[model samples]
Target: MMFDAWLTFAVIAGAVYLFVTEKLPIEVVALLVLASLLALRLVSTEEALSGFSSPATITVAAMFVLSAGLQRGGSLYRLGELLAQIRRGWLLALAMMLLTALVSGFINNTAAVAVFLPLVIAATVANRQPPSKYLIALSYAGQFGGVCTLIGTSTNLLVDSLARQSGEAGFTLFEFAPMGVIFVAVGVAYMMVARRFLLPDLGIPEQSDTGHAGRYVVELLVGEKSPAIGRRGSELLPDDAGDVVMLEIFRAKQPVSSPRGEQVQAGDRLLMRGEWRDIEQARKKLRLDYDHVARDLDGDVAAERLHAEAMVAPGSHLIGHTLAEVRFGHTYRVRVQGLHRHRLAIRQPLDRVPLAVGDVLLLDAPEKSLAAMRSDPGLLVLGERVQERTKLGRALLAIGVMTGVVTVAALGWLPIVAAAIFGCIALVMLNVLKTEDAYRAIDWRVIMLLAGVLPMGIALQNSGAAAWIAGIAVDLVGGYGPVVALLTIYLLTTILTEVMSNNASAALVVPIAIATAETLGLDSKPFLVAVAFAASTSFLTPIGYQTNTMVYTAGGYRFTDFVKVGLPLNAIFLVMAGLLIPRYFPFS
Candidate 1:
């Protein structure tokens, strides 16, 4: 290998290792890879940053904004709520599968999944079923739906860009629909079966008892001058307490579990579990305040205010801080009642647990503070809607804009990228979503990841690394004939996708697929189509695709669940793609 090829392989190997271990957020890892390439002089700064301006990146970002507008307008929620009325589990699952896939075919799958997420969660809550059963299906549906159209996923667009870059015609809108629809049909059938046997029914979430606001356990200290010093614990708080339950009382450092009628004393510690509103009321009644927070639960709970669930958003600066270090109470004006990490809930003495990207916080904050937290991109309020209901006029306008964008692109009046950008502008002008929120709606993490990884692909192609890899693949599989060579490319792309960003996978593997086809003296379009379809079929891992990651925490699923359900589905897809790609594109 040449110097450039060696450098490219080294970077790829490092990136793959980092992605697998997840020591750093994938976006950060991607940026690091980009910076390394720049430092190595493998590519110019322009090439390194070209992905930011790439149509695939812009289209994905615009789609996010557009989806945010629709979500903000309450159109998606309304549909979700309607779907929540379905009592039969199988029917509901089918509806979600079909709806998510259908919408994803037109819009970005991440946005489609996000819009539908709350609905599935709410429906699961109402049905007293575990969200785990349905969320994976939703993620899978998004992938299937995304494959149905050119704009359905950034992966497809990335492949299209690669094709054009490689001197081939780009895919027109709906060009993949025929094959994509078949794959979607197969996916839907597979998911329906998985719903019955593969998925787990987790029952009601532990926090469900606290109602839609979520539950939190907090400790409060009684001041010497507090009004409730002589009062019984039950009487000191509200009669209903809004699902708040006093779990324990510590008098003179002695533990008392379920102390309902215990009299309060100055400096006495009380452990409580309840909703944010209830916690706030109890704190006020006890004269507890944020400034008076005890050093530990044994000391006091004065500084903590309310109880609710807050998820660390992707790209949040808050990712690696412990509650005490962050001055979390003072900083966010809320106290964390519990920590839910990796689907496991940890309660009490939460001072040292470091927050991660997907860790959900059971927080206690005042109503005003909680409202403020809602707008903070660093934290996401869960199990409730803090924003106002979407206006019907604005929602209708958003729907119209989305339809217009799709129409123009489908008709070739404007490219998907331009149409999507115009639609974003329309959303803001029509008051469907605010300009600031529109920008915020775009997940910069994803944007930067795509931007950073695109250049890596350029580097690979420029360094002859892509062709070298493709030639080797062809040599290894060419003896097996063209059909097997096609299957090998499709399978390789699918595997790579599960371990990396779909766009990056498509970018890296498409060149190899093209080279392999050329080596076999066959039309490359079949191989290209196979790679495109394969790249979008990321079912084996939660981190494989954007939509899967979105649902991972929301559904409270383990990584193994994806593997369990996705493995079979992936095999089925591999077979389906191998059989169908040549029929559609023709290897001869």
Candidate 2:
């Protein structure tokens, strides 16, 4: 028993360390933990594999499919367009955050951010403000909004699932809403205040010109018998050149997206855009002749090619793959000239930089193909193409399915697992989402993490480690009563969540919280809710929540930015949870 206790503690400690450092993927670490526990006989195979069949894991997986269905239906795009129309400023920031929170309450927070990201960029540009002011708020709103519903995040579901496994009633669909509403209100107010003082103004120069004046769009002609002839378009540019992006290539009088693998020919007309200084330097660096008359020749030339701006969609196939690897140019018949992510310009080796979901690409393609571009579903064409088509019928059906899931689950007509799984099947059956896409929609890493860590919790219980720790914790704070013990659970969970994944934190601490409450001869509801809330309130750092990390790079924010803005909010949550949990979930 002693050896088992020490081994369990060491495994948990190592898991925490790996989660913090993130040397490997979180799922990999989770699997490692599961494998170690099984190999060491700490947990049997049946116990270790139980999480895969757990209601929480299934529900979370189903939610991902539901979220993906919504995304594919183009509902999120419409929301973004509506938000972009709002007048830009503090009011806009507040509204964006509120709307983001509201939408995220039902759907995945990451999807909310992914859908609204480009819209926020447009809002900032229209408002003539740096994205730094609003992007972090967007991230925070998603986090805060997630706490509003049991399905708002995987953390709540995990806690509720564990509670049920411990023989307590699971959370109702709206059970989290009352306290969650307060958290969202406080978080929004704090972020609005932070925007004025704490957020940095990342240098995004205001657009003074009406028609791409600050940017240079130059047409370069490949010289006959030149050194660049017969090489791929991507090979023509220097590997380190970050200055120029290829917008369009009039090859044999045709235009395409990314010319990554296309062999460059003499007399090929390349239309590129970048900073004038960078372009000028790049022009000299790459042997090319300027096409002065090509600008005028456009009047006489066939209308086969055109230049446009496109925002990479959230679930784009292009994401995480390099242009060259994806044959981006060949596939789309488009030449990518410039790229922007999170409202900031990206520097070269454009072909090598893996594309992210929200990146905005400047592409040159055939004018006729622009209409067909909507078929890609991965790239959302901005401006004129904003009215791109979607299957409204399918989208409406998807929304109805999600609503039905909530209604059934809320009414207790079915368990959340049953409702959610049914919703997923409906999505696939009604053709709202493809079966393959449904599978892709589920984040396997999260599944693995939950499946792996659940056994550790079981081991803790079976080995009496949880009760042992609970006894120590309660004894240390029992003299102060249940309030202190509850707060300790909340605070510790919150701190751990800041450094590791929230789902992991909940899995580790929820059992301890339950044991602590039982040891005190108190109802465990308040303590359990405290763990759920604390695990979800990871505001102090970007690494705490997936949505926070989504915006960190896109917003061009430093680690301290989250601290500077989210620290106060964390404190506010701490006080609120401490006060409200006991009221709503008494410790009798």
**Which model scores highest in lDDT?**
2
Q: For model 2, how does the per-residue alpha-carbon lDDT over 442-507 read when each residue is reduced to its tens digit?
A: 777688888888887887877778899999998799999888899999999999999998888898
> How many clashes would you count in candidate 1?
9
Candidate 1 off by > 4 Å: 210-307, 313-333, 343-355, 365-380, 384-388
User: Model 2's lDDT to the true fold?
Assistant: 0.78
- In model 2, state the lDDT of residue 537: 71
lDDT of 2 at 391: 70
lDDT of 2 at 402: 91
Candidate 2 vs. true structure, TM-score: 0.78
Q: Highest TM-score among the candidates is held by which one? A: 1
